[model samples]
Target chain A: MIDPVLHAWGWEIPVYLFLGGMVAGFMIISGYFTLKGHHKHSDFSSFYLPHISLFFLSAGMFALFLDLEYKVHVWRFYTTFKFTSPMSWGAWILLVVYPMLLLNTLVSIPKSFRNRISIFDRISDVINRYPALVKNIGAANMVVGAVLGMYTGVLLSALAARPLWNSAMLWILFLTSGLSSAAALVHLISPDKTEREVSAKADNGFLIFELLVIVLFLVGLVTSTRAHKQAADLLLTGPYAPVFWGFVILAGIVLPLIIQLLAVNHKIRHTPVAPLFVIAGGLLLRFVIVAAGQASVIP
Target chain B: MSSRYAMVIDTAKCVGCMDCVVACKTENNVPEGYNRDWIVQDVRGTWPTLHMEIRSERCNQCDEPPCVETCPTGASHVHDRGGVVLVTKELCVGCKACIAACPYDARFIHPDGYADKCTFCIHRVEQGLDPACVAVCPTRCMTFGDINDPNSQVAKLLTSRKWHTLKAEAGTKPSVYYLT
Candidate 1:
């Protein structure tokens, strides 16, 4: 029967959110780069984007698997996709997004037809048959990536059980966080001058958006209609307090903001440290927010 | 013929003995570490002001089944004959999406690594027998019947008593009703 209490969640749920955030973040950043013409004739696009997308997607899938009671049976999700469930949406997103990313990876091989027939010819000639199609597919992947990023927020926000996460603002917050973290990771791994400049602008835009969303999220928490105010208390002083303040607020918000400010002001070089710090902050932010949202300590 | 079957539970008579829980596990041959159905007991405060209540929670077998809708490969589907939700293990790719989608935590991963949950004992019902839980409930707190049939025990109870479903706000429209 309907009870006058919140439904308790398992630890795996939070981890699932965290991983999803990361994957979405990476996909967004990668998409942003593609939009800005980062995936031109450079071998970097061929080598990095697909591989990284696969890594993040696989990581999120693994986290989802770990969240299950019978994790080994997780494959059943592939065999089973229900339209009414958010889990189904996520699975569908993965199914579409991952293959698109893989396609980008496959076409990167210059000689696709040769690879198919020549087993030895790594770059076959078949991809040339559909160059226009391949490019369109690349663009599609970016769009899919952006949608994937937003869906993570929608996933949690759709769960009415946890009032703290039940806001449309979550979609914006998660998407911003995802893109910011993705840019941060890119800045850390590759120091390409052109990519770095573009990433910097994207980072600035994302950081500003995230800061606003965080404020709005907190406002929602404080002014909740029900016992949701407890979530605010949890964020401020409960088990998630240290995480919220330390990682989300301090490292994620403050540190990144500071680094961006210094870089914009010419006070600091665009060194690896700043972006690395931002990446760390972003990852930590996801971890804490996810944890905080799932924790229910109403007595 | 299509039928909307249901379970009616009388929480007032439940003694928290977990007999139904055990019976469900044994009847379904549920995995040792996992339970397709179980009881959740909430007791507030210490001795003096303490209030105790036990809820036998399982897959609500909602009319709008989220698990079935989320199954990408059609592994989980509603049986049109009895409106019972069933999971086809052979078709299941083992994706835990259904588990996450189900708000009740009713679904669990089976030993064979497929999703499984309470099926309302369709097999037993086909044999003209009550569900194992209904047969084994020492307090007779649980009842199963065709809500469509006015003469069914569940129909009588629904007409006579106030009942509720868990997480009704989720729009799952669960068939299982509880009288607290």
Candidate 2:
């Protein structure tokens, strides 16, 4: 039986977290490509990815809205911003994100598409008039993307009630995972050989960092107080172990890492399967963390 | 000086009859399948020499409430009169951040899509009366009053007896105290 006291947050949360992290990941990569001029080589990197990132982010926000019991009262979140509250920070961040993503998407549209769409032509003309503005937007995307990535983890870590979530390593772990997942997504979609190689290499690096951060997170929890140790046990030897090991570790990180490495080195052909695993792993990581965190209450 | 309202529960006197639980439910009109207060039985030691401690649990109304800190809106705030942690339903988006942040597991999602928890019977206390739980407890095990007032029963009990708060290490500095 599910413990009543320990099951307040349900399935919706992990889904929200996963989507939020994915958006951040995609934004960071898209921003990086735009800034570094990789967009010049691949039209997919410049245009499609940023729009896709915004789409996913909007979907994620919708999921978050659905989770709210008082959906009509959501305006209250904007009435006053509390510096101490992570939720408040997240709300404001999301507010900034929508407009920023829209701006990026507008500027990245190809001239051919802009010619066909008069509104896009006018918007692109204005944006193209100032080269520095485009660069500034790209930089803003990178910064905002990083904050959005870290915020997902910080949101959970801020909750002191759940020992499993109160880890300093969580934010780093989440950011790296976002980066890896984003890279994997870009690698899967980009037709350019150089672009795919770069993203694949980056994903491999991010996966390594994510693995270390996960280990450190567990170490910190296990070496802490009794409650924290119990929280660690939830993932280590408790009911969640199988999912954590099978899905999050093996399938999500290790298997994806191996596949990506083989693909990068030309030992194996790059298939859609590796990126798919990375995305699934990213979603599952959020799911396991959120579910187990709720279960690891101070009973 | 303003009152800092608190509860001093004498666990030794409690029989776990759940009078307070029923009273709180009825008084607050808390939804079914949800609660504002309950009882916890902590069983210790081997079977032959086993001992069980039955304690009544409710919102601690923490001085440094994590729930308040985590709330996106100011829906969860400490009342100016007595520092009572209360939720303003109209402002609550029911994001469940406070529910996750509370160590005591005191808060619940009200059916109306707002967070709900113990209010220290603020309505009754405003009229200089005890909370419903304290008034109905058969053992008279609960003392509710201003902890800042030395003359108050809660203050007197706290000063004279050795007591502890649940999850003291949580750093919440809860207003509720339990006498062992």
lDDT, each prediction: 0.70, 0.87
Across B81-173, the per-residue lDDT of candidate 1 in tens digits comes to 568888878777555556646767676667566677888888898898888888899999999988888888998999999888887877788
Cα deviation in Å at residue A130, candidate 1?
12
Task: Tell me the TM-score of model 2.
Answer: 0.96
Deviation from native of the Cα of residue A251 in model 2, angstroms: 0.7
lDDT tens per residue, model 1, A30-80: 544444444555434443756776886677677666655445555656654
Single out the weakest 10-residue window by summed lDDT for candidate 2 chain A: A1-10
Q: Evaluate residue A219 in candidate 2 and report its C-alpha lDDT on the 0 to 100 scale.
A: 98
Q: What is the TM-score of each candidate against the true structure?
A: 0.79, 0.96
- Per-residue error (Å), model 1, residue B62: 1.8
Evaluate model 2 with DockQ and give the value. Answer: 0.61
- Which candidate has the top score in TM-score? 2
TM-scores of chain A in all candidate models: 0.83, 0.94
